[model samples]
Target: MPARIFKKSWLIKSIFFISAFIILVIGGTTYKKIEDLSQSSALLTQTYKVNVELEKIFSHLKDAETGQRGFIITNDPIYLDPYNVGRENINSSYAELKVLGKDNIALQNNLRELNILIDKRMEYFEKAFRFSSVGNYNDENFKENFYNGKKLMDTIRVKIKGMIDSENELLRKRQQTYESNLKVTPMFLYMVLLLSLVLMFITYSKIIRDLKKIKAANEQLEIFKESTKQSEIIGQQGNWIWDIEESAFTYSDNLYRLLGEEPQSFTPTLDNFLNFVHPEDVEKLQKDVDKMMINEDLPFIYYRIIQKNGTIRHFKACAKLHRNLDGKKQLLGITTDITNEIEHFKTLEERNLELERNNKELSAFNYVASHDLQEPLRKIQTFLSRLEDKESSKLSETGILYIDRIKNAATRMRLLIDDLLQFSRTNKSDKAFELVDINILLENAKQDLAELISEENAIITSNKLPTINVIPFQIQQLFSNLISNSLKYKSKDRIPEIRIVYSKIKASEEPQISNPKKPYYHKITFTDNGIGFDNEYAENIFVLFNRLHNKDEYSGTGIGLSICKKIVENHQGFIFGSGKPNAGATFTIYLPFI
Candidate 1:
């Protein structure tokens, strides 16, 4: 059994040594290459993250300067939007860059200078705003501050550019390393195949003639029967060979075990096997077996089996016809316990039905919200408009005030209806994927928000973006909602400044995304200097109608963020929001791209 015939044959054993050495070489190469690839991937992630964060700092600083200038010229508090936004994001961007670049001494040095330049620019911006606040908006003072702030801004941009250039260089190096590993992996596979062929040739030379000389052909029949028992026992299954002419059967050892019977006690016969079949399945199982016998084709059957203890379980039987040496027919087959698999399938089926019902109910609710709820609000609003037009002077002050309250309530109801309808429709958007250029998408959203941007003197800066495969309309809706939400929550005393930028990451690197066939995701960030809410409400903000502020403080239906979340999910992406109160909110979207 130990192959003692070769126990003292060192020359023969060298073949095994060669095989092991080849395996070790192949395995060691794979391990080292994988380790190198992982490190390169991590370095690439850090490089891009640091580069993006630096751009974010640069972008926010510009927003602050723009906000300061807008407030100086128009003296509108809304112009401070970007100033407050820059204050909220600049520090966080620096912190993020520091963490991402902690391994690189040069980047850290660059970050230190970046911090100094941004601070200097911000200080001049504050002075300009301070002068304007104190009635110091003279042309000479304005020109002096303006020229100084622009100089500081230009210096900050130069420093940020240097950092970005260095990171791009690092990214290039890491990508080259990763590509080299990909090339080496194929060479490893080729070497492994060559080693396997050498081993196989050596083995064939030793065994080719000796196999015919030493082993009887009949040995296979014994081996097959014994293997059947071992396999059935391991799998909690059974096997049988039926002799068609003799009307007799041979059962594997585990066949008796499967029926909860004593081994070797029961006779192998058709009636005995049928006795174990569930009462309802007996006639069908018999009919299938008779058909398989006549047709001599492989047949598969799934039925319930009642064991000796009366517990019913699922079983799958498959059989193929064979011919004996004497030309007599035989049926060789296996049966497996499929109770657990059957139960799991049933559970999933029930869940699908339940989800179908829930979808129908939701559709009905949306219909009611569209028709029943909105019609009455429309009537109230139309009547109020008519009364206000025809009875302005005749109406008493109290009457007018009551009419105004009714109109306001009706208007609020209309807003509520619209928000609800939008929320209900979020997941129902057409799922057709298209190549959506993010630059064009952002431009459309900007165009839509053009009036508000000019009214508040808001500043929006964006970097070159990518084209992503997504539901184009849904992605456009996502951009529009995120930008509008930022404008709506802008700080009262600061100008609204918004910056959009992106970083690329591998889907396998991010733990939250699952089953990524495409390796890359573009993390597009929308940061705004507005009255950001508490971090605890980050997820809560994406729930329908979950508002952090009173209606009087912020005029929103609070469903915009929820729609943004749904759209991201529809594209197999992720959306997240985080902010500190009064600091500003950052909405980060992860969308897959080629």
Candidate 2:
């Protein structure tokens, strides 16, 4: 609202009018004052000029009297020349005196008296000049005429002095008026100038105060803007900002942490932030950002991050873009960490898989127990029934013995079914992880089958073992089954040499062997020197009810390897066996560290 006020139509119009009024007042006042002063200065200048001319005329009158006296005494014609020159100057000066005296009766009367004296002196000079030309220039008569001329001239000189005094007095009075006007004009102008300055200062001070208020209002607006921006950022999980003109990027601390980074450690940039995104999701994110910036087309994105600790986390960034007043489409956005959410989703998926697997295994177990195992069991029972039905007269001892053997076969079938049930039920067990010492576990397993190992003369050797975090019972069962297999399938007269080797391996071996871009792994090997099965059955060994040999030849329920496979895989690992028909078998297990 304040921003709008500065741009108001009335405010701008008022400023323009006020500024024009001030300029007009100052300009008009200054012009009028200058005009009046110019008129006064012109009058003073004219008065000074007239006064100077009057002083020159009086000086000529005095010179003319002196020249006439000098000519009468020296009898020099050169002196007459000056008198003639002065006489000629008299008429022109008289005209000037008349003009200067236009409004002054006193000065006009003095000029008339001055003209009378000049006419009397001219009459006397003319008579003297005629006597001199007619040779009547006798000293006695000439002296008398000179004396008469002196007396008349003295009287006229007194009048000229009086006129000169009057003109000097007028000049002095005019000068005094000019000096007085000059002295008072500056003081009056200074007062007016000082008043104008004070008025202008007040006006400008008001303008500056208004400007300061506007500045303060603008500062408050900025503060409000920052507070609003901060609220928006904190409410969202993470936020991003783009300066369109600057072509730069800015992100909140949450965004950096979402990408598993420290804000202070790196500058936020589109390229830098996107680099942390999983490669599979990079193209989509880049395209979305580009479209938002270029065409104002916003898009939502969910991507994964491989954290600094090598943990996988998921994130979703969402926003919409519109042009600001400046026409820049800033990409304002929020990002949220979805690692726990993704984990929960994965757990649900895994749970579903386990349930489905349990259902399938149960179905297979029921089918196999009824069809495969029961069929043999039913035949054995039928044979024994037939034996009992036909044994009328004292049954032959051999017939009873053969019937007992058939019953034994039926009993073994039932035992196999029971063993399979036990194996399938392991999936349903909620076993928690505990520290499992492989060396101690293997020794106990060997002790359980000590009699068989001693009778077969099998040598079960183990390298130094590790205490791993695992389901202890599962690990024990795993090693026991493996050892049992080695002893059971040993070549006759060739003692079994079982070797279990465990090493602390770096998580880098055969990592890319599965998928080059996948994370690394750690491997543990269990190798045995015994009669190995065919390579074709290597994968099948871990299948329920799958056997490499007939039931009559090997003593197993065919669930041992399957149980071992399940245990290793539940820990996010892989179990695979490699063997030649007669050489030996080696099972290598791989598990991720994180």
Candidate 3:
């Protein structure tokens, strides 16, 4: 109603100002200022996005140059593939920039000059490439061609940087202007609103008493009741009034609709209302009513009702109690259908319970399997050691080979059992959450691998770990598995260099590497300079029994990463791994903060 009144008043003002042309100047100024503000905001946002895209484009150009250099030095065409692809993308990107800067002639001219320079640079570089392609790899002009291209690229970068800075300055000025207009706009609008409110009050005062004298009391009551009934029906709500002293009641027809019953069946009595409630909710309903009788204000409640068809329906009831003329309390208010909302909540709850149950069952199975298998595995290892130590000379070469294979199989099985059991325990273990110092955790894991570290002459370093809410043992296992995997996958030639770091990050943006569920988390990263695998296999690496190398080449069950993933997930956190082949790997764990 207020919005409609405002619109009507604005329309009238617009017409009157058009006829007189006196207020037109002020209104035009206001409208123009608002338009400028909106346009400036939009332009500022566009410029920011353009600047980001420009930076990305620049990075791609650099990558293309790097690829070209790599291919030239090694005479490998594969390395040049990305360069050709990047060159194709760069042309389209520059075309987009031209469109973006069409409104700014100065920026467009700058870009045109940069493009000309790039053409000159590419022309010389192409000649050098042709020389190399024809087996004239010792072309004396190659160094000069590379230097010319680098200088041209540098000039292009400087021109783009200047345009970005100039646009940012323009955006800053627009923002300042926007802020000034915003401040003045509200002040002028408030003044207009104040004058309008005064005029309205004067009009109301002149006619209110006269109007009241003409309206009949019972007619007003009827109008009020009719409006209330219409509102309840339209809103899918039911209104009721309980007269405690008279032991009588009244309800809108909407109330019967809410109960899934006909109006004729509703008796407007206390027991009639109670009969509609579910048997399980009757006591709660009575208690709420009794509380209203005593306190005149019973807080809102939700309860279920059994419809005529025996279907249970949920309702949200809210009531206010007021004293009648006789000083007795009367309760009046509404019951709204909330069946859909309740059912949705129940469905979500059931899904959660189902997931929890599945996790528990998985964990229990792992524990049982590990315990049962350990006895046989221990016996096999013991027998293999005795056979190797006491009767190695008596065994034939084939027999010796069989014994070694058996030992390797037994070792692999033991590791698998251990990994599976650890994964299962994450689901069943008591979640005793506490602030864990991650720095200590990483140091502990490093210490556990001290023998391997010394043998590889590994370099290990870490930033201070944050204290976060987590299950300590699970955190330990998470760190240990990741670190061990790094060492186990190291290049046989190079010394391993590992680094652990931690930082705080928003929960939603948390790395989907592990799938964490909280709103804020500590991100711990384990980086290693080892022989990394293909990035395409990042997901497969986390699955149970997944292996990038043959078992004989890289020993152990492939369940390490899977267990680490499970532990992180159970703690409502995420873990992810990224790396280039032979460029090393980074394993990140995001554990939610308490």
Each candidate: what lDDT?
A: 0.83, 0.71, 0.77
CA deviation > 4 Å runs, candidate 1: 1-234, 243-248, 308-310, 320-331, 428-430, 508-519
Candidate 3 or 2, higher TM-score = 3
- Note the residue pairs that clash in candidate 2: none
TM-score of 2: 0.44
lDDT of 1 by residue, 1-594 (tens): 123333434544687678777778877877887888888888888888888888888888878878887888899999999899898899988888888888899988887887787777778887887788886677687669878889888888887887788789888988998898878887877878797778968866766544543354437656976886688888888888888788788987787887778787789888988999999999999898788778765467988889888889888888888886557999888888888888999999999999989998998999999999988888888888899999878999999999988887788779888988987887844467878687898898889878988999998999998887777777888888998899999999899989998889988887866687578889899999999989899889999888988998788887888889988888778888989789799998888766
Q: How does candidate 3 score on lDDT?
A: 0.77
Better of 1 and 3 by TM-score: 1
Model 2: weakest 10-residue lDDT segment is 511-520
Candidate 3 lDDT by residue in tens digits, 546-591 = 8889987888678889889888887777778888899799998877
| Top-scoring candidate (TM-score) | 1
Q: What are the TM-scores, per candidate, against the unseen true structure?
A: 0.57, 0.44, 0.55
Q: Give per-residue CA lDDT, model 2, range 177-280, as digits (tens).
A: 66666677667666666665666666567667667877889899899867755664454367777776777778876666666677646887777777687888
Q: What's the lDDT for residue 464 in model 2?
A: 84
Q: Which of candidates 1 and 2 is the stronger one according to lDDT?
A: 1
In model 1, the clashing pairs are: 79-495, 80-494, 80-495, 81-494, 81-495, 81-496, 82-495, 82-496, 82-497, 85-529
